[model samples]
Target: MEKKQLFRNSVFILFFLCAAFTVSAQVRVSDFRYIDNIEGYWTMKTKLGLYAEKWKRVDDHTWKGRTMRLQNGDSSKVDDMRLFLEGDGIYFTIAAVRDSVGEPIRFKLRVLKAVGFVAENLQSPYPQKITYRWKDTKHMDAHFEGKDGRVSREIIIQYTRQ
Candidate 1:
């Protein structure tokens, strides 16, 4: 009888520990509220052309967006983008609108805060790291950084809410 009781106690303790670990590992979608600020249209002008991005919240756990190239009073779609929560992490994914044969690259969120977040894809050959920072209510900055061979390259863009 004592041996049976000891085995039962051990089983209960093991089950309790597994439940606790699972709860601690779970991530809630609501924890990333800072990303909500990205919703809306943002525009930036470069010497080459004017570009814009529009983001819309699909639900509490997802945002869908697209990049547009503006010229001659018209806009053309350049890329499709999305942010979503999966498993225990959030991911940012983007792909060129014209690249029908290529898969959208996925970047896992590495850091998140009230000001901004950083996402990275080590498998991507170029622009492996993407960072977004909020400068103010109406302004934001994005940086794309990667190594081209032995040379490091970075593109920085400042965007204004439109």
Candidate 2:
């Protein structure tokens, strides 16, 4: 009976330790450091063509990026983006080349963690929420969700580090 009790106690203690470790392993959003992980070239293939997105650090607190199509060894710019830390939070903006007015749609970073981040723009007509999740160092997923009129839609893109 003593040996049986000892075995039970050991199993219970091991389970408790595992639960504690799992709870502590979750990441908390403290700052924008995780955003730097995306500084490089990323690519995704679509039915239209192969598209690429490249990111460059403008300063310690800002990054500039552009999405383009790779065709016949030439690239056409689709959208320009800027991500920066401002006033204790981070913001993301994107401007399409056709928008000559130079106003970019803006999103505020609402959720940030070691795994990824979520940004939302309630005023945007299309995508009100944008989420980026890292599968690993070489792969990431981008999700855009919003409502167009009363219809809801979502787009998910998987990007490979290039």
Model 1 residue 31 CA deviation (Å) reads 2.5
Candidate 2 lDDT over residue span 1-162, tens digit each: 999999999999999999878644442334678887778999998777888889899988898988899876777898888888877668888775112455777788877777788888887877888888988999988798999789999989889998
Q: lDDT of each structure?
A: 0.82, 0.81
Q: lDDT at 111 for candidate 1?
A: 72
TM per candidate comes to 0.75, 0.75
Where does candidate 2 stray beyond 4 Å? 1-30, 97-102
lDDT of candidate 1 over 40-102, digit per residue (tens)? 899999876898888899988899988899987878898788989988788888774112457
TM-score result, candidate 2? 0.75
